[model samples]
Target: MSAPTATAPVGQTDTDASAPRRPRRKLLFIGIVVAVLLAGAASYVLVLGPDAAADEAVPVVEEGAVIEVGTLTTNLAGTPAQYARVGVALVLSADADQSEVTARFPLVKDAAIAEIGRHAAASLQGEEGLEPLRRGLTERIQAVYPDGEVVRIALTELLVQ
Candidate 1:
């Protein structure tokens, strides 16, 4: 008979049989570790990276003070005798004096009415109309005050008929 061969224990495989499995398990473990590391690096570079600060640079601007100038009704410039009822408010610059603006309320109201009367009923139809109206009112009020106190004009209410 040939030389007797070596055999593993009844419940276990020989070392040579398990050697290949050890290397495969090691390779799988290494692959998982590499994948985890790559994912972490990608996340940090995309989300929490250096460019984040520049992307987050949103400036905060303070809104100036506002003064309400009550509503006024005036006849529009167009034919057929149209009238517009408008409510006005003034946004004052940061250094403007509240008491001064309050004292000159009548002049402000008059200028607002005059400006409204310059625009036709059709001109005051939509946002296209209202923006110019605001700018004109601001200019007139500025002319009366001449102090640059009024920074913007807001139309709180508007109705044409």
Candidate 2:
């Protein structure tokens, strides 16, 4: 009689079948990572878009205060035949109070009166002569406050003697 031969169990081999499944699991892990990155990027863009647009639409304003000016009077230097006496109502701007304008009133008044007396004709016959004088006086008032401007100059009373 021959000795009994040794045999292996069914469906059991020395090589592993789970080796192929490892590659498929790695591919699934990479896909999940890429999907998470894309979702994070999309969320950031949607959140900040409106705030960026609104910031551009707003405007900035300057800060300061406004002051009202009253009328000033001064004498014109010249003979009665050569010059006409003028009275003007002017509106000006200043950062200081009425007291400051009052202190500088004499200087501003004199400058305006002198300019008008020198440039204007003694007898203004028509609109041509009057228009030039009005513009000239307005410019003179502006000189007093270089930073400020004159809004209006009205010849309330004008007398030639």
Q: Which predicted model would earn the best TM-score?
A: 1
RMSD of 1: 10.1
Which pairs clash in model 1?
none
lDDT of 1 by residue, 1-161 (tens): 89999888787778755666777899999999999999998998887896777767954334479989899999989874799999998888888889998899999888888899999999988899889998899889888778677777889999999
Model 2, span 1-161: residue lDDT tens: 99996554578553544346778898999999999998877776687664766777865333233332344333334554555656665554433344554566666677766766665354354667677777877687667756554444567655554
Flag regions of model 1 displaced more than 4 Å: 1-63
Best by lDDT: 1
Cα error, residue 80 of model 2, in Å, equals: 5.9
Q: TM-score for each prediction?
A: 0.59, 0.43
**lDDT of model number 1:** 0.86
